[model samples]
Target: MNTTPQQNTQDRPARLTVGVVGAGRVGPALAAALQLAGHRPVAVSGVSEASVRRAAALLPDVPLVTPAQVLKAADLVLLTVPDDALPALVEGLAETGAIRPGQLLVHTSGRYGTKVLDPALRAGALPLALHPAMTFTGTSVDVQRLAGCSFGVTAPEELRLAAEALVIEMGGEPEWIAEESRPLYHAALALGANHLVTLVAQSMELLRTAGVEAPDRMLGPLLGAALDNALRSGDAALTGPVARGDAGTVAVHVSELRKHAPEALPGYIAMARMTADRALAHGLLKPELAEDLLVVLADGANGTHGTDGADGTDGANGTDGAPR
Candidate 1:
């Protein structure tokens, strides 16, 4: 009787040797995850002090070598360099004749799809684009986070199964992204995840400046519930004064931010306008109330509050009028 591929694993080698080109926060964690999936990590290349430390911690005993050496040693080579450096690195590797035929060349860049690896593909290497949606701390914790993280995957049609299988082996869910859609997909993730960090940090700083102690503690539950609600019910989760079309409350907020956190005023006004538009589109903001709210936002945007004094200060409350 002929043995199936699954049963024939005992007769053939099972583990693919993994290599990392950049020992950045993302690379070593991924290599560690692959190690847990029974893959052998043979080599990693990183020049910085931080990279050396991370690689040692995450891939202990895996020899640190050059990028070309990494490609030479492993069956699956992870190109975990920065997005901007990826194209050049691939070209250089292909030019130097480092890439082997049948080698798996995987990159964890959200920006580019498989096209960036065409040079490597022309060298007879297989291309895989697998971008993890989660942030990394350059620690073992990243490995655990992979248990339910989503990976934005793009590959040649013939290699789709192979790409998804690699994602699953690293304990990630595979979310297929079209080659042409990679840029938009990456932009959406950056808009959400990256901007959320900025927003949260700004909110905490504003709270601190407003005489609040333990701002993190105060915002913890509030932000958590807000995030959960927004995730569960998108536009319907719009709340607060902007969503309710409370022109007076919004005006007061703009006045206070102008008085206290002038630097934050622009971002506040921009997000409020966006929120107001979304609320109007969702029918959450009443049309009758939207007119005044939009005017307030417009005034805020133009650095002309409805109640500004001659000094360009929001004179609704008497205080220093500095735009600083």
Candidate 2:
């Protein structure tokens, strides 16, 4: 879809009226941000009473209404419902003729784009996707952090401009993405943000099993440094025994894991093999060394035993045994 910038408003509009449906973690946070950006959150709705109560507390001046009422009152309707519920909600709204011809319909789901709003589009509404590439921890702290974050925007030609404008108004940089590429982009975010949580949890469990008290304290500095390095140098920041192609050290880890944290072995092996592949791509490991390291990691995956190297020490070359 075309992504030309919308007609620039020299001055911000005086309180653009907004309606928020689904007062879950993301919904209320976004509604709060909209309010901060000089928007009037005129209506709020959600499936659960608790969610509705939460939204009412956040936007006490706004009326708590049914989804249909929100649609009717809002110039811009935000479907902050869970991703799976969005299509059904749009269909229901369209069937009820609640959506106006020129109203802007937006959703916060990262996994989907404007396609989920097909029903709204059929009813002549502008469909837009405005997904902030960040996690919601269900706190005001998260809402405060929304400023200057990157948002993934996708929509039809006419709606794309509106989507970009909205994101900019929210103090976020808009990254235009093809509608069909939303899934891949979401997956990348999941890998980096969500899976990183999984990896750290697994590592912490391993450390706990190894008798490390206060695992969080021990991991904090190490993770902080690693993250800083990754941000500054990308893949070049890789380190540790796996990046070094130190087969002997890896074998030691496998043996210790088998005894201490067998449950974490599979994840360790998977991440190690993936890291080895990255190291190879960076030319840090010779093909033979990479193959050997892969074998060790694969053995861990398969619950099998493997020798680290011929000499029972690290591999022959110091370069092969140093961290990448």
Candidate 3:
């Protein structure tokens, strides 16, 4: 990742003095990214042991101070606190008269826009919402990942250029998001990224139950291709039993899930129903076959078609071994 320019560093002066109000995984990583772009990380605030370690490792030599002190010291302050804590934090900082005139106040909350920093703005702070659309590992690797990452940017119309420039300086692409659309924007990202982790974990657990030695190795290329196809083709990438309207296969899957992994059954049925709906709407599932598939899914939802108290060996070779 080409985070730093090839030009001589001794010539260009550092852009701004950066401070992190919360030394969580995202805070340090972002501060480190800004440091790579010729910004100085002067102060950070961390409470937990992990957060302190992250700050020490990522922002070496930077002083660990209070949140108020962070705002008092740095030109650019990153409010990387949890979503629920953001409002009170900003309000408290502004109430304490910590915000300086013309100071840059940036936050990394996906669910919020610049509106959350209204108090700071009133205190003469320039509010900017720059939420990076990537998971952070609280390591130097995250700084490199910022090179090609996309930042969901929300700021005042007058400060649009400044927000975009800051994102660019941190080696990120700026994606403009309206203030009113921030919640929906965050919901979309969470639905895809966060839920995908749960789905992958459930799949791995099911594979392990089915005697797969290395589930990650088994899912690596298959999931990679599936994700690539879904990204490239959208709804047209619908495949598997739901897309093919294989009601019998789906019924067997639900039965096996009920017998082997009852906890994962709900998610499997929910996702299958959703996939069926999309497949039907996208012309992927034939109308004639969809009726039976829908019935199978409805049965799965109602817990009526699966092996409730039977031997749990209905659609296999004597005993339940692996997915057929």
Candidate 4:
């Protein structure tokens, strides 16, 4: 992830003394990356044991101090606290006169934009939302993962250039997320990343419940390929029973889930319906075929018996579970 060299842009951003308000998963990683790019992390505020250990490991020799001390010692303040905690922290800092004008304040929260930093801005500070689009494990390894990543950046027009330059220095591509669109932008990430994690965990659990000892061995390749194709082709990458409009097979899947793993049925049905909808909209399944599949899904929705819609629309070898 060679993030050592930064592009010498015509409008270069100056390296400044940095203060990290939270030395949690994201803060230390950003601080380390910024340090690698020439900025100095003078102090950081960390309360939890994990945060303290993480800061020591990632930002070695950097002093762990109070939030007030952190703000007082730096030119750039990186506020990497939890999403819901940001506004109050900013207000408190502003109220105490800890944050002064001319300093730049950036937060790594994807759920918010520069608006959340209103208090600091009113007190004469530059505000930026510089969210890196990658998960962190609160380790030094995260520093290397910054390369070629996209950063959701939100800032006032005058500060956009400098914010983007910082991303480039840290080896990330800057993506401008509109202030009003921040919520929707964050929702998409949550749905895509967080929901994917839940779905996979559920699938693995169901596999184990079905007596599959090596669930990962069976799932790893298939999931990896599906994810890769989905990224490359969007809805066009869809495959299997739903995409093929195999009503009988779909019914069988619902029945098996309900009979053996009732707990997983709801999510399975929901995802199946969503897949059918996307397949229909993307022209992957014909209108008639999609209508047939939807009926089976609707039957599964009503009860554990997936037989109602399986009579007329099923393929010739109905119970064989073969795709169209």
**Using TM-score as the measure, which candidate wins?**
3
lDDT by residue for model 3 (40-110), tens: 89999999999999999999999999998898899999999999999999999999999999999999999
User: Between which residue pairs do clashes occur in model 1?
Assistant: none
Q: What value of lDDT does candidate 1 attain over all alpha carbons?
A: 0.89
C-alpha TM-score for every candidate: 0.91, 0.88, 0.92, 0.91
Show the colliding residue pairs in model 3.
none
- Runs in model 1 deviating more than 4 A are 1-14, 307-324
Candidates ranked by lDDT: 1, 3, 4, 2
- What candidate 4 gets wrong by more than 4 Å, as runs, is 1-14, 308-324
Error of 1 at 121 (Å): 0.5
Give candidate 3's TM-score: 0.92
lDDT at residue 86 of model 3 (Cα atoms): 99
RMSD of each: 6.2, 5.8, 3.7, 3.8
Candidate scoring better on TM-score of 1 and 3 = 3
Superposition error at 69 for model 2 (Å)? 1.3
How many pairs of residues collide in model 4? 0
Q: Please provide, for model 4 over 272-316, each residue's C-alpha lDDT reduced to its tens digit, 9 standing for 90 to 100.
A: 899988988888888887776888788888894656235644441
